[model samples]
Target: MNTNDLKIFEAVAAHGSFTKAAEATFTVQSNVTARIKSLEEEFGVELFTRTSRKVALTTAGETLMQYCKKINHLIDEAKYDIKNAGQIIGQLKIGCIETTMALKAPEIINYFAENYPDVDLEFRSAMRSTLISEVLNFKLDAAFVSAPVSQPELDQIHIRDEQLVIVSSAQTAKISEVLNKQPVKIIVFDQGCIFRARLESWLSAKGIIKYKSIVLNSLEGIINFVEAGLGITILPAEVMEHYYAGRKLIAFPLNKELGTMTTVLIYRKDVPPSRALQVFADMHKVQG
Candidate 1:
């Protein structure tokens, strides 16, 4: 019944931990527990299924979360209208693949930060697979990903092309030159990474299915591995040039099929776009 109760409920749902939710909301754990108990009594329904380690939303809580987001969004907009003259002032959570950070995200983020000083902007780096699901689940406001997503529930915009290149240490043989005789050593992100899948597909099509694989999380890590002659990796040409051009690495064009990737901006189509989202789209449109 109380607005504070809703805030506490939302925090608990987001964190799945009463202690963590309490810390987030600047309250003691017992207070959080009491507020949640009061909320359950007021609503006449149990909101969460509790366990020793964590809590999960019950069906009623699941239903309520959608309404909670809407209510909070409306409240944020009303506050913005009254105090900030309808300027962007609420939270915007945008995600992007790691490569976008090197190419487009910095510029867009800088522009948005300068233009809308009151907005709370969160930039999360995520794999496309994870980013898509997060966007669909309303965990992310929008995401920049590799284009042509298959989800019917989402909408996308073609942003730009990322020119991918194979970077190998100068001492290593060219990919085509080495593949027939031996498997080309490759550095890749993780299994679900779209770029990793693309590289694997390209290698498979070359009849070179086997390669020594090295896993790394960051682009810098990949570059370092490739520069040490450990393996070759495919990354944005611009990124490689800007960051590792001084290093002892050679860049070769990828097979046309795998060389150029279209960067796409994706968001849920089912929900009306928020003003912050609208401004994000506009910023990209104007710059891109």
Candidate 2:
């Protein structure tokens, strides 16, 4: 019932485990357990069902946890707003896809840093879905994710549309000729990658099936795999310019109707905007 108890319950629900949630909240497992137990006692309802290996939320837990997330977010936002009202001197954590680091990150960070030297910035790069989740969970103040994010709680602002180009080794011209060829290695990032989903759907539409693949966690790994003639990959044109400059990779267009991949800035709409986030969001409003 208390804010501390609700915070503990929220952490447990988000992580789906007591031990993991304890680590995340910088507390011990016993404290997390006691807090949740106190909360359940006060509510006269069992919030979570305990199994030997996993924790599952009961109906009451699910409903309560949803509201807890909102309450916790509000508390954090209020603190951020109060502390940063007149100055910009707090740590701002933003998340992004790995490719965003190449050029866009430097330009944006340099501009922000030079203008507001007191505000410390931290950029965490990961798969797009992970970034989206972090923003939703309040772990990140904001995130730049490949767009079409349909989550109701998050507000998304379109930044730029980057072309998704299919690239193959130049020496393997025959691979380009046959859209549904054998020995096709689809080099892709892990599950949460936006382009990886796009490429799979594209292949399905073209009736190209049974292709080989290599799962890589980083942009550079995918690029290296493709450059070594190990496979072909799809990537945003703007972000991949350096990799394409003198490589044996040949770029091909996805059909025009497929459209460009959209880069978007997403943050919780209901949360009071932090000074750091407000400044960052303002930069996305491209002047005509």
lDDT of each: 0.83, 0.80
**153-267 in candidate 2: lDDT tens per residue?**
9987888877888877776675446464685678998887777888878887877767786998878788788888778888877756764577767777887645387788899
lDDT by residue for model 1 over 199-248, one digit each (tens)? Answer: 78878877777787799999888888888978778888888777777898
* CA RMSD, predictions in order: 4.5, 4.0
Candidate 1 runs further than 4 Å off: 1-75, 180-183
Residue pairs with colliding backbones in model 1 are: none
